[model samples]
Target: MAKRSFVWGLGRYLILATAGLLAFVAVVLVALRFVNPPTSAFMVAHQLSADDARVRQNWVALEDISRWMPRAVVASEDQRFLAHWGVDVNAIQAALDEYRSGGGLRGASTITQQTAKNLFLWDGRSLFRKSLEALLAVAIDASWSKQRIMEVYLNIAEFGRGIYGVEAASQAFFGISASQLSPQQAARLAAVLPSPKKMSAADPTPYLWQRVRWIQQQMAPLDGF
Candidate 1:
């Protein structure tokens, strides 16, 4: 009788704990729609680590950032950012088809999805993490505007080892403000998004230059979107 009572008590406790956690997360997500997040999980992690350098980040409004930047990232990362709600089903289908045919695995994460993960979740790929990311992405999309989402993404995305956001990255690499970045400079910054730590906008490798050109080509179609 004692064992069964203990089991029931534990189940009740778990249920309450889960509910409390979900409520907290919901509040935070809703709050972010109005408030610019001062930092992210990645930034916190880096700050906590003794070996990692201190992070550099500056918040800027979407309008203050270059027009080319949004277009470049849309072209380079998720072309369907405007259309997709939280997840891009078509990209997921294509990725699955590629994988089943013995092609290399590809990421199908949309900008919204990446924003959710970077803002609320931790690093690493796992079913659990992806599920959480999907849920939060939905919440973010439901609450935030597309422009707001882009603003948050640009400000929080890690551009280099410690450099965070277009403002810091532009200053560090090109000695320009985020608003002053030229088209070519924006393309170069977007090109390095896939792997910022390995790629450098200041000293572009052959592969990085190719990516820069491709992103520049894509920018034309994305204009005024």
Candidate 2:
């Protein structure tokens, strides 16, 4: 009797899950039809104990992404995160062009793609994962407002091995809230994302400083976009 009940419950969930997916797809198709330009990317964070195994970043507001993180993340990841939609086709193409022949791979993953992968999938490098990453990116862009997309990215981006979100990054690095990050301070924090344990916003390296300068250059073009 218990086994039968479990099976019934699983079946019910499967049905509901299917319905949810279909609804989500429908909404996305409608959004593509309308296609309003995106605003900002923001997500809240939740502080956690150092030893906790879950991600540490959290979301707080819709406004934090552009104001605090835009310059910083653009410096660290893609300066073109805003100019493109969910994917950076030029970056991808350039990467592919630069790849060593058949082995040439590209960084087509945009902010939306990164957010989708980080939130729902496992970490690793593979074509299969990339495919899934792209699918989720499109789905996310379809469903979320640009502001919402940024919100999720800031919240989900892994700051440390265990740390995540702007909130956690802010507290861990600056002992402040995400709302309080200055452009320089934010750039320093963004630098740590590639290797959180090695570098720091509080103590940046020459390379990070150079990267920061480059990101500033990117802002002008992005602003025009």
**Best by lDDT, which number?**
1
Task: Estimate the TM-score of every prediction.
Answer: 0.94, 0.69
**Alpha carbon deviation, residue 183, candidate 1 (Å):** 1.3
Stretches of candidate 1 above 4 Å error? 1-3, 50-52, 223-225
* Prediction-by-prediction clash tally: 0, 13
Candidate 1 residue pairs in backbone clash: none
lDDT of each: 0.89, 0.66
Q: How well does candidate 2 match the true structure, expressed as C-alpha RMSD? A: 7.5
lDDT of 1 by residue, 1-225 (tens): 999999999999999999999899889878888899989987887778738768988899988998999999999999999988988999999999999999998889989988988887888879899988888888888888998899999999988888899999999999989999999999999999888889998999999999999999988977553
Look at candidate 1 and tell me the lDDT of residue 179.
95
Q: Where does the lowest 10-residue lDDT sum fall in candidate 1?
A: 44-53
